[model samples]
Target chain A: AQTVTQSQPEMSVQEAETVTLSCTYDTSESDYYLFWYKQPPSRQMILVIRQEAYKQQNATENRFSVNFQKAAKSFSLKISDSQLGDAAMYFCASGANSKLTFGKGITLSVRP
Target chain B: NAGVTQTPKFRILKIGQSMTLQCTQDMNHNYMYWYRQDPGMGLKLIYYSVGAGITDKGEVPNGYNVSRSTTEDFPLRLELAAPSQTSVYFCASSQWTSGGPAYNEQFFGPGTRLTVL
Candidate 1:
């Protein structure tokens, strides 16, 4: 069974600061994908960033990026220059063989 | 595009009851999925459909059922609702991009909050 783990239950970062949320997964498949999703108070699952297992270059989407180390099975998300709107529950999900598995999620609190 | 839409935004059911959660997507995505988000837990896949008339069980599908009669609509049915079934249900859809990782990129719905007493 494939599993994604986000060790941190909650994290706080002051505005304009950078925060990195850690994620690790165990999968036996070679062809896979990783993703970060943000769920706000509205309960909407918004895609923040994505990474392909075959891509050596980390994926970056504006202020959100991911350090995906395929061999180590570590996929961490880095949010830079965070804003007030960045406060939300962040989820790490890994997908392969038509199945997507998610970590427990980390709650991010952006302090002003 | 409306993306993925789930109906019955909030519902409360008694034990042994049954209900159907409606999900529809306007993006015409071929792959649709059902997931349950428990309190302080990761989203668990309940079921998924690749296209019309084709559906498969996911990680957690023991107490639930789903059907895809068309590409746009996939409905999830919960039978003999138990307290453990209470959770936020999300519907997601994605288009399969050949030779690409787009197949794993799923767009989620607003989610349905279900409570069982």
Candidate 2:
């Protein structure tokens, strides 16, 4: 069984600041993938970033990046230069054997 | 590319009623999935298909049924809609090439909101 955990229920960040959302996962598979997805008010799920377990280098997409510590089973997302549009629900997921287990998610609010 | 699309942006069903949620992908992905998101919760997979005519149950597959007749379509059916079934459903697709750059990164649909009374 695979399980992802996001401990914080909500987080607030000021404009132009940076925020890091923590996520931890447990999986038996040696080879797998990690992902961060964003769901806005429009109910659209968008992919934020992804990391492959085989790769030692972390994944970064523009202002979004992930700190993936494979040995510790921790994958946290960092959002740099946060804007008001960053406010949404972020979910972390672990994928293996064609299935993904997601965390409960954390709500992010941006202050201007 | 239309990516992934789901029909019926919003729907309301009475208890005991049945409905099918339609999903389609034009990216020619080999893997497709169905997931439901409840209030203040993460998305849970209900079903998935690796290719045409190959369907499998996911984490939460009790009340939902799914079929993948073609490479482009995967439909989920609810036999008996209940209050617990009220949630937003998402359809996603991904390519599964071993050691591919975009492997396992799923592309999602806009999601369909369903409420059962």
Candidate 3:
């Protein structure tokens, strides 16, 4: 079974600063997809970014990007120039064959 | 597009009560899934359907039942609600492809919050 772990339960960053949320996974499959999802207080889940296991280059979407290390089984999300709106619960997920395994998630707080 | 819609955004039920949570997707996606998120916990897959008429168990499938009679609708049924089942439920759908991008990028609906007393 595939499992995802996010060690940090809570994270805080000042506005305009950068923050990184750590994630790690255990999967026997060689090929899979890793993702970061954001859920604000409105309770809507939105995709932040995604990284393919085979890709060496990290995935970036605006201020959101991932440091995906396949060998270490680590996938961390980096939020740059964090804004107040960036405060939310972030989840790391791994997917294959329509099944998605998610980490416990990290609650991010941005202080202005 | 309405994307994926889950009805009854919030629901409260007494123990042993039964209810059905309705989910519909307008994207014409061939894959649908049901997941529950506990407080401070990650979402856990309850059930998934590749397409209409095909449903399968996920990591945590106990106390949950689902039916996919039509491509657009996948309803989850709870025969007897329990306190442990109190959590936020999300419905998601994605396009089906042999492999790669389409299969992994799932669009999620605004979750339904349920509380069992």
Q: iRMS for all predictions?
A: 2.2, 2.4, 1.8
Candidate 1 lDDT over residue span A75-110, tens digit each: 999999999999999999888866689999999999
Point out where model 3 deviates above 4 Å: B99-102
Candidate 1 segments exceeding 4 Å error: B97-102
| TM-score for each model | 0.96, 0.95, 0.97
- Where model 2 places Cα greater than 4 Å from the true spot, the runs are B98-103
**Per-residue lDDT value at A78 in model 2:** 98
Please, what are the lDDT tens digits per residue for candidate 1 over residues B1-117? Answer: 888899999999999999999999999898999999999998999999989999998988999999999999999999999999999999999887556653457889999999999
Error of 1 at B3 (Å): 1.3
| Candidate 3 lDDT tens digits, A1-112 | 6899999999999999999999999987777889999999998999999998888999999988889889999999999999999999999999877679999999999999
Q: Please give the range of 10 consecutive residues that has the lowest summed lDDT in model 3 chain B.
A: B96-105
Query: Would candidate 1 be rated incorrect, acceptable, medium or high by CAPRI criteria?
Result: medium
lDDT of each: 0.92, 0.93, 0.93
Please give, for residues B29-116, the per-residue lDDT of candidate 2 as tens digits. Answer: 9999999999999999999999999999988899999988899999999998999999999999998975654346788999999999
